[model samples]
Target: MSSPLHTQPLAALRRQLLSRDISPADLLHSVEASIAQHDPAIGAYLQRDFPTALAEAHRADLSLPLGGIPIGIKDIINVKGQPLTCGSKMLAGKFISPYDATVITRLRAAGAIPFGKLNMDEFAMGSSTENSALQITRNPWDLTRVPGGSSGGSAAAVASGTAVATLGTDTGGSIRQPASFCGIVGLKPSYGRVSRYGCTAYASSLDQIGPMTRSVADAALLLQAIAGPDPADSTCRRDPVPDFSAALQGDIRGLRIGLPKEYFGDGIDPAVRAAVDRAITLLEAAGAELRPLSLPHSSSAIAAYYIIATAEASANLARFDGIRYGHRCDQPENLRDLYDRSRAEGFGPEVKRRIILGTYVLSSGYYDAYYRKAQKVRHLIRQDFAQAFAQVDVLLGPTCPTPAFKFGAHTSDPLQMYLADIYTIAANLAGLCGLSLPCGTTPPTAEAPALPIGLQWLAPPLGEATLLRAAAAAEQLLA
Candidate 1:
């Protein structure tokens, strides 16, 4: 029998824990059982800490907000004494976190248990989990297809019912694309909205840690637990966090939603387009006003994002040079050989490609031509959103251009792989909050199984209250 606890939403689980309807150990076991049955096939977790989690559950404070809840953390986020492989051979078994990330501390304080470290693309560098140097994570709905990445395992764990909710970091579309492909809710909160102190850096300026869950409400709860300033992370905003769960009243009457013309044009799959279009219609019928808007710089988002993101990634990833920590080459000829060989042996192809491209753009002679130009374009994209938001409460689009594709589909073509994030990248460039949720599903074909489609909602920075409210309303209609 399917365990009700395993599939229950975070809010329901919280209520159950608070009321003593279910003991914390019972809840943990339901998740443990689900993981045992499904994780081998899904490959969502890289390391499991059931003993530690079980102990935590036993002593959990039921009166706390997330009391007794079990959560799977992305391998990039550090948990004290846990292995943070980051889906790469570089840190596999060698790197152990000595402290908890700010989010982990917040979750623990709110009474949640960090059950395990989930997998991801190596260093969060790819669009699919296929790039992970460790293991492959498959879509729970169709095992042959890929779960999107670099947050693939995060979305997969939640979608497969192994965890009630999980955390994922978004640089470009890492969280949202995977959530779309896996048919779950993913939120990429505004940059600086959540602390990044303990989460391994990808593109520091672009990355924001957020929640992946079964419903918008759960996403809200997870976000609430993690959002706020961190003294360790200077970039994190000091703005007071609102009660996100209480904002999901599902009433969005007269809300203005913007439909971006650039997002609806060329390259979007017919199935995905149909699904998002249907969601727009449903929202309109529920009393939202739809207005056609133009984010003129949208076309340049991909180019600028890659240049800027990789430039930042090149800087952030330079720390793992086999000097102080991480993998060290055997019998190195000298320091130079150690740096070259260790990196060569440790990084996956995608990570290497990005590093090279990033280094090239940031090189002295090319900095002004490539990196600087991209930064200019990034500014324009943010301005486009500012102008659009002034006229509408939120912007709507498809989360991905197409549904989940089979493994190896885009691995050979890096540009094509990057394009998979076209619809979701602009939000990161603009430093705005974005969400992806299941709106509909495509029919099965001879070569491909039925896949889920996602509708993306974008809001102004710190506008998650409005975004979640509208998403909750549309979620009910979609249901």
Candidate 2:
């Protein structure tokens, strides 16, 4: 039997706790029970400390916004005293965070108990958790398929009822894609809306931390706790944090929703296209105006995203040299040999591929042609959204081109795997806030069960209030 605590959303648990119907300790135990029952099959968690979590729950102050709620942290995010592996051999057993990420500090202030080290793509490089050097995280809905990553573990934990909510970082579609695959809600706040301080950097310009939860309201609650500025993250915006939960009460009547023509064309799976079309129709029926618009630069998004992201990743990952904290070579003949061997040994194949691509793009001869041009394209992509937002309140479309794929399907072709993020990377490149929520599912085959489809909504930077309001209003319709 599933624990009631595990099955309920964060808001429901908060209400129950406030009413004295369930204690925080009870919630913790329920989470433990759920993890014990489901984690073996899903492989969502890298490590969990139930004793520490339980103790915190027992002492939790229920009055705080997130008091006693155990929020799972993606391996890339730092939590004081916890293992800080980015799902690579480099830091697996070697690194312990000496301080909390700003987000962790915010969560703690909101009374949330940070619990486990969730699995992720090594250095947040891949779209599937298969890149994790530790273990593969499978989709809870269909174990044969991948949980879209590098936030796969976070999404699986929520989808499998092992976590009420969790934090996932998005550089491209890390949070939103996994949520789409796992049939949950994932939000990637606009760049600088949330602090990046202490988060292991992937592509610095594109990454943003957000919440993955079972419901949009829960996402709002969690986002409320974590969305704010911090001096520690100079990139974090100083915009006033609104009552995200309160924004949910607003209706979408007369809201202008944009349907980017480019997103509907070509490679999208027929089922995914149909489902998202239905979602747009439903929103239209719900009093939203569907304006077919164009993000003309959309065709260049994937190419530009890879070039810029990899280039930034090349620079960000240079800090992991053998001498400091991560894995070191056994015995080095020289410094160069030590550096080469240590990195080669620590990083997975996918990580190495990205680092190499990044390095090549930023190489002296290629910088102007690739990296610089990609940055220019990135600006044009952002301008595309700026122009679209002038005509609409939000942009709506399919989150992923297809539902979760079976394991090993794209492993042989790295480019195929890269295309899995085609629909999502633009939001990051444009530095816009976006969300993914379950809209419907594809038809089940004799050999395969129906997999969930997701509809994504994008808002201008710091426009999460408008984003959440529209999403909450559509949640019931989509359901």
Candidate 3:
């Protein structure tokens, strides 16, 4: 029989301490046991810190935010003294982070143990864990299917019970799609709400750190811990951070939700559409008004995201040329040869593919035609959201066109994977807050695997409080 420690929320685990039902060591033992027994095939954990984590858990005292909860960190974020590989062999055998990422610092303050780091797409470029420079992080639901990337391992960690919850970075649906795939909640706060100080950059403009957890409230608690300004990141916003958990209790009565016609167009799976419709019905029942709206420029969000994100990626990744940092080529006649050979050998096919595409788009002659046009399209897309928000307080849409697809399902074709993020990219472009929560499940089929559908609730910038309230309301109905 499973112990109470084996199957309960992190919050409940803390309550046991008050009643002396279980010592912190006993609780940590359960988590450590689960990870040891289950993670071999899953590959969710990139690195585990069991002894130190247990030591911290044992020392924790009094009412705490996370209350001795263990968590999984996406490999891109720096956790002082932990292996901070961004899922790449380029940085293999590397462990020299001098500072904690803002989120890690906050997690420690909240009494949460940073137990491990999880796998991700190399440099966070792919949609599935298949591209992880480390081992592939398999989905907890089907094992054969993908746990979406570049935050795949983080999602898989939470879903597989390796941790009660995990942190992920969303840059083009990385967080929400995996959450939808893994049957959990994922939030992407507005840009700057969460500090990006110690995070490795993929697409600086698009990347924002967020949380993945089993419940809306649990994700909310994680968000509270991580969302705030940090001096190291110049882009970190200084706006007042609201208490997300408290704000979730507010009434969403008369709240307006926009359903974009553009997102429901061709390529959207029928099952995904049905699940989102069901979530919409739930919101309507919870006093949220719904209306069909048009984000005409949204159709171009994919093209824009690719150009902008890849351009930023190309620049950010230039540092990995392997002279002062990372893996250097063994047989090099000179400096240029060493730089060329190191990057060429270290970067995976997908990583090379994007760098080439981005370089081409941002090159001298094509810059105005491709990169500049995409930026203009980005403005139009942002305008669409701004105009729509004038009429509707928030937006509702499918988190992904489908769910936990087969491992190689969208990999053969790059366009297919890019299209999967069509519905979620505009929020990032507009710098708005959004979240994905379990809505309904699609029945299994030979062609389509069984997976949870997520309803994406998006609000204007700095609107996380309202976003969670709406998500919780929809979640309550879906439940």
Each prediction's Cα lDDT score?
0.92, 0.93, 0.85
Model 1 lowest lDDT segment of ten: 1-10
Q: Against the hidden reference, what TM-scores do the models get?
A: 0.99, 0.99, 0.96
> Runs in model 3 with CA error above 4 Å?
1-7, 18-20, 446-449
| lDDT tens digits by residue: candidate 3, 129-176 | 788877988988888889888789988878787777889999988898
Query: Residues 1-479, candidate 1, lDDT per residue (tens digit)?
Result: 65557588877777777788898999999999989989999999999888989999999999998899998999999999988899999999889999999999999998899988888999998888998999999999999989999999999999898988899999999999999999999999999999999999999889999999999999999899999989999999999999898889758789999999999999899999999989988888889999998999999999999999999988999999998779999999999999999999988888889999999999989999999999999999999999999999998999998999899999889999999999999999989999998999998888777899999999999999998998999899999
| Per-residue C-alpha lDDT of model 2 across residues 86-195, encoded as one tens digit per residue | 99999999999999999999999999999998999998988989899999899988999999998999999999988888999999999999999999999999999999
Q: What does the lDDT come to for candidate 3?
A: 0.85
- After superposition of all CA atoms, the RMSD between model 1 and the true structure is 0.9
RMSD of 2: 1.0
| Clashes in predicted model 2 | 0
Residue-level error in angstroms, candidate 2, position 164: 0.8
- In model 3, the Cα lDDT at residue 449 comes to 63
